[model samples]
Target: MNLGLKTAVAAFALTTMALTAASAETRVTYKSAKTGSSYYQMGVELAEAMKAGTDGDISVTVEESQGSVQNVMEVRARGGDYVFTTPPALVGLAQGGKAMFEGKGDPAFDEIRALFPIPSLTMHFVMSADSGVTDISGLAGKTILLGKGSFGATEGEKYLDLFGLTDQVEIADAELSNAVAALKNGQIDGFVTAGSYPAPNVIEAAASTPVTVLSMSDAQVAETKRTKLTIPAGTYAGQDSDIATTSLPVVAFTTTKMDDDTAYALTKTFWDNKAKLGDTSPWWNGVDPAMLSNIEGKIHPGAVRYYEEAGIALSDAQK
Candidate 1:
């Protein structure tokens, strides 16, 4: 072979190796919890599905974190390949909520997208029934602990923003576990948690202490509409007959960085295995595969591919 031709062939071989290695090494990080909560479990399920559906073209690793806020930061930093998060936190990150990233900075809204609209998250404000806190206003002058990051904060802020309760309530932030402990120890007058129905932590906290789960009033619900929200039915625990409550919408967010093929694969795998995931997590029972269309933020290209292939129409914005 000519000397120049030999060099060219060597270079081509090296480039091919590099590309193959990169493709084979594509890794996805999924953050959830170690305690095996339904949310975390669902994340694991999705990650596993993606890996399997892609036939090892992509590999996902599940890790535990402080839930949505941490997931958002990790994915934004490229530390996480994908994240499972609820809508309010996704919006809060977009709006730059305080104490986020330890004030490192706000989440870059443009870099993020919604993979799917998760089932509704019932915002739980647990107060002793005897505490005479029948309405949101009644919680005023009491020491309240909202879940850490923005889970609890969003609910309290939303309620306050909507009901003009800024001057009425005193709010503090606490991790979900700590907030539950605080309520049990009488260290806090009330504890707030926003999650899918029968949130294990809230249920455990409520069982330990007699408490009431406050529902959003009509006006408060209206304000929530200003943000992207969904209220699917059949998602609550003890939510029938005795303590019935309506649904609230929440979305599972992703980043814009996910490639079209990968995103489509993930979306397709999730929908295909929806029944199994729902059976494992009651919170997902009523999630209509059809509702994936309404998720907010920019739609991912992969998701677009998957939906289109599934015969679901896409908006121009999605394409």
Candidate 2:
């Protein structure tokens, strides 16, 4: 071949190589609203798993807590590639039921879809047993610190309403740590938190001062579940033991607009390596593949693809 022809062919090959390299690089960012919490730790694990599962083709950046509201906003703005949120948050977004979301107008929830529903989270209406606080209904007229910007806050209110104690209780908004501290300092009667068992924060307080986890009778559980106030097993760390408690369902979600291939790949990568992801924090030990995508709103096409490929049937809505 002529030397000039050989040089032109080599340059063409180099350009093609560069294009492939760019296409092979995928950058996806995952943000969780619960910063410094077990949820964030789980996200980090999921992010790492996704990176490794994709054979380094897909890269993930995890930023904990931009707040659930903000996370939803980011997803809508096309700023965030993915996020984790609770069922109430998911339902509120899907149904435009943001009667309590602070700040700007509600985003379009119909645009969001469930990636999975983590195990149910027991709603701990915490107080010192020494304070004579046993049931949520007993905390009437007392200050209750509920975690802010979380579905826990909504659950706490629902708990109050479910038990006909709404008018009896005074809601105090505070961060998890601060609320726990407030209870310790006698500023508030108790703090309400919802999570899978041995809820780290609630356990932290329980370890310090003896606290009681309330389990209203089956009748109450039914009412709370129906009304959105709840506690669920696996929420406490010692589920293998005799501790029995019901919990509220907490669903995690992502946007519906994501392409099917991306969602499918993301879901598969995360679940396949889920065991390793939980190693970072025991909080994720409860995440089950069976629990994935079990709540309201239709599953995103990507999620549907993953489930179907795995031999799970897709719902009619998903189809």
lDDT of each: 0.64, 0.66
- Tens-place lDDT per residue, model 1, 172-239, is 65665787677777777787766676577866776677676665566665665633333333223332
Per-candidate count of clashing residue pairs (backbone under 3 Å): 3, 17
TM-score leader: 2
User: Clashing pairs in model 1?
Assistant: 230-249, 260-302, 264-302
Which candidate comes out best when scored by lDDT? 2
Candidate 1 Cα errors over 4 Å, as ranges: 1-27, 31-41, 51-58, 63-114, 119-121, 140-143, 147-149, 161-189, 208-210, 224-259, 290-294, 311-313
